[model samples]
Target: MNDLVVQTDGLTKRYGERLAVDSVSMTVRRGEVYGFLGPNGAGKTTTLRMMLGLIRPSAGTVSVLGRPAGRPDVITRVGALVEGPGFFPYLSGRDNLRTMARYRNLGDHAVDAALARVDLTDRAGDRFKAYSLGMKQRLGVASALLGDPELIVLDEPTNGLDPAGMADMRALVVSLARGGQTVLLSSHLLTEVQEICDRVGVINGGRLLREARVDELRGEATLRVRAAPEEAAIAVAMRVAGENSVRRTPLGLELDLSADAAPALVRDLVAAGVDVHEVSPTERSLEEVFFEMTAEAPTTKEKVA
Candidate 1:
């Protein structure tokens, strides 16, 4: 049996003369959170649509749980929230969940269980239209969980959430993964993705630039040093690490060197009579890496057919 719960091979989507998703391939292993990251209009939604069998790919294939995409059995094992949650505004949250459960041939007990999982049992009786945006998002998640699916695909799940709501969603995702469900999360929020995803695929201009573990894609560690005699400190850093290895930051000088190199660098700065106040190694955030990767990607003109 394949270890991967989701796999896409050369998935491509074209709208007339325009290529919306170009040869995108990705994999999501069982019991992991795989982030699909890209800016708005960078084919994230398009790719997701194809994965959920909402739209057919122009080329390539998608397999879910070892079965081809769009197969009824395979789809039943997957739950997804693409675009946003849609339900009858007049209906109560519980009624909406019940309605969805009926459509999926699920029992009323499934609705209750899903609501409890999302901590919405208390508010499940409220009208969908009266629920806050965060509440609605949670309802969407609850609906997805109604089938007790093995794989969950969420696109920008936290888009309308406030900070607290975002935090709650993150915690819920982590909890789900810990409970052994595989999750495919698509979003442009780098920090959120970095925090939750075990691995991430960076996409831009309808093309996937790279896919790597979160730690691997974080890039290199840099030394952040605050010292007096800024000019002297910079010179010393450049001499020790090389001219291209040093740069100025608002707090101090940042050296493009590993944490292991920090000791030698500090000694060199101190010996040079530079009053070093602090020296610490800092890991590059996902945002920095995202910008670096996307900026280096070949520019393309927007085309629509």
Candidate 2:
């Protein structure tokens, strides 16, 4: 079987005068949680729509499960919840699933299994209109989980969730991946994506900026140092980490050197008559990296997997 569950080649979408999704090529491997990250209006939803065949792309192609996306064969093997859940308000949560299952010619056991997977079994008898926002989201996920699809796509699954609800949703997604499901999740929640996704594709201004494992996207770890006699400390940092690798920040001088070099850096600082106040290691968080990428103009594409 192919390792890739989803692949898009130069996927692009335009809206008359506005470009919704620019040329984007990305891949999602089977059994990994792939995060589609971007800000509002950055085209995360647009790209996902194209992949699910919910909307036609202006240009480019989407292949799901090694076949053209949206075909009956492919769609049956993939499940998704985009924009939000829509169920009959008058129907109980259990009935809603039953109704949907009937449409798909699925059995009652499937509906029961779906509700259980989303932890909605406790509220399965409650009316859909009475469910909270988080419950509704989970019910939407339950619907997607029907029929045991191989790939699941969730768009902003924690959009309106409280902190606790968000944590629950994260745990659910992690559990899904552990159960051998490929998930392509789209969200603006940097911390959630960092905590759950194995790989991420960053999009901004309708274009894909970079796609790689979360760690790779964050780049390397750096040594942070604060010392008196700033000029001398900077000189020492430049010599140790190269002039181009040394930069100033509110935290102090950041050198593109690993934490293992802390002793060497401290020694150099002291020899240069610099009074080192602090020396620690820090790495840029996903939030910081996201801001930096979105702030810049679209650059050459990074490695995509």
Candidate 3:
């Protein structure tokens, strides 16, 4: 079996005068959650469409499951919920899944299993029009889960979800990966992506800026310390963390040293007659890093508005 679930080589898409997606290449590995992140109109949706063979790329190519994207055999092995769910409002959620299942030649058991996976079984009998935005999103996910595809592509899957609902969605994604399935997730929720995705591809201004592991993108963790007598604290931090390794921030002094060095640093601070107030390990948030990477790129129309 191919380790790469999805791969694109110089994928490009043009919309008349506008370049919707520039030359881009990305890969999604098997059994891992790959986060596709970007601001609105940053070509994320366009790239996804090309991958699904919903739209032909103006240039380049996309491969799914080691074959050309959109091949019948390859597409049947992949499930996707993009843009938004479109189902008959009059139909109950269960009926909606059943309809889709039948079209795919799947059985009723698959419908039930999908509904249960997304925790929509209790509301399966409710009409689609009566469901909340979050409920509708979950129902869409259930529809995608039908047939138990090897790879699932979800675009903003947690949109409109409450905190609890979001947590449940995160767990569901994690569970999917654990069960030997790959997920290609496009989300604006950087914090959520950081928590769940193994690696991420960040795009900006119709260009892919970076592709890396979550930790690699965030960089190394650092030690943050707050102590009385600011001058004394700075001296101690420099000596303990090595010269030029400490920087002053509004929060406190941040050192390049690891958390394991916290004990010795604290002891040194105390020995220097400094009153220690707080000491904790800190890591950069994905949101912070995202802004820095895209700061130089032009803002998309959605962001400008």
Candidate 4:
């Protein structure tokens, strides 16, 4: 079987004078969570909609599960929640699922299984209107799972969630991926994307700036050292790593060297008679990368330990 569950080629969308999404192309491998990350109005949602066939692209093509996206057979294999889910307010959660299942030609057992997968069985009897926002989101996920979809596309699933709710959502997404499900998660939250996505496609101003594994995009790790005679410590770091690679920080000196070099760097500083209080590895946060990619101005690297 092909490993790629989703693929887009030159996916572009225009709104008369405005270019909503500029010639974007991306791929999502099977069984991995792919985060579509971008700030507001960056066209993350638009691209997702195009992928799901909710909207036609001005130019480009999309394929889902090895078939042209938007075809009935292809749509059946993929599930999506583009915007906030809308359920019949008068119906109970279970009833709502049952109704949707009926539309999908699914049996009651399918409804039960979907509810169980999302941990909504306990509150399945509660009216949709009475369910909490988090519960409602989970129900939406349950509905998406009704068809036992091979691919799930979610657009900002944590949009209105509180801290705890966001945590729950994260766990849910991770659990789904662990179950061998492919997921395309669209979000503007850098932390959430970094925490849950194995790979990410960063978009800005309707343009895709980069696509890379989360670990690769994290860049090189820096050794953060807190030592007395900071100048001598910095000098040692500059000697070990290039001078341009060493930067001063409020905490101490930061050397843009791999974590494996920490011991050697520390030994050099200590041999130089510097009082080494601490040595820790610090990696660039997703937020830093996001800002650096999106901002027009040159970004100054900040120490983060």
The sequence of per-residue lDDT tens digits that candidate 2 reaches over residues 80-119 is 9999999999999999999989878899999999999878
Model 1, runs deviating above 4 Å: 228-253, 256-273, 298-305
Tens digits of per-residue lDDT for model 3 on 1-305?
Answer: 78999999899987776788888899999999999999877889999989999999989989999999999998889999999899999999999999999988999999999999989899999999999999999999988889999999999999989999999999999999999999999999999999999999999877889999999999999999889998999999988888889999999899998889899989999999999999999999999999999887775553210
- How many pairs collide in each candidate, listed in order? 0, 0, 0, 0
Specify the poorest-scoring 10-residue window by lDDT in model 3.
296-305
lDDT of 2: 0.90
Identify the leading candidate in terms of lDDT: 3
Candidates in descending TM-score order: 3, 4, 2, 1
C-alpha positional error of residue 190 in candidate 1 after TM-score superposition, expressed in Å: 1.6
Better of 3 and 4 by lDDT: 3
Question: Which pairs of residues collide in candidate 4?
Answer: none
Candidate 1 lDDT trough over 10 residues, lowest sum: 296-305
State candidate 4's TM-score: 0.91
Residue 50 in candidate 2, Cα distance off native in Å: 1.7
How many steric overlaps does candidate 1 have? Answer: 0
What residue pairs clash in candidate 3, if any at all?
none
- Error at 33, model 2, angstroms: 1.1
lDDT of each: 0.89, 0.90, 0.92, 0.86
Residue pairs with backbone overlap in model 2:
none
- Deviation from native of the Cα of residue 246 in model 1, angstroms: 5.2
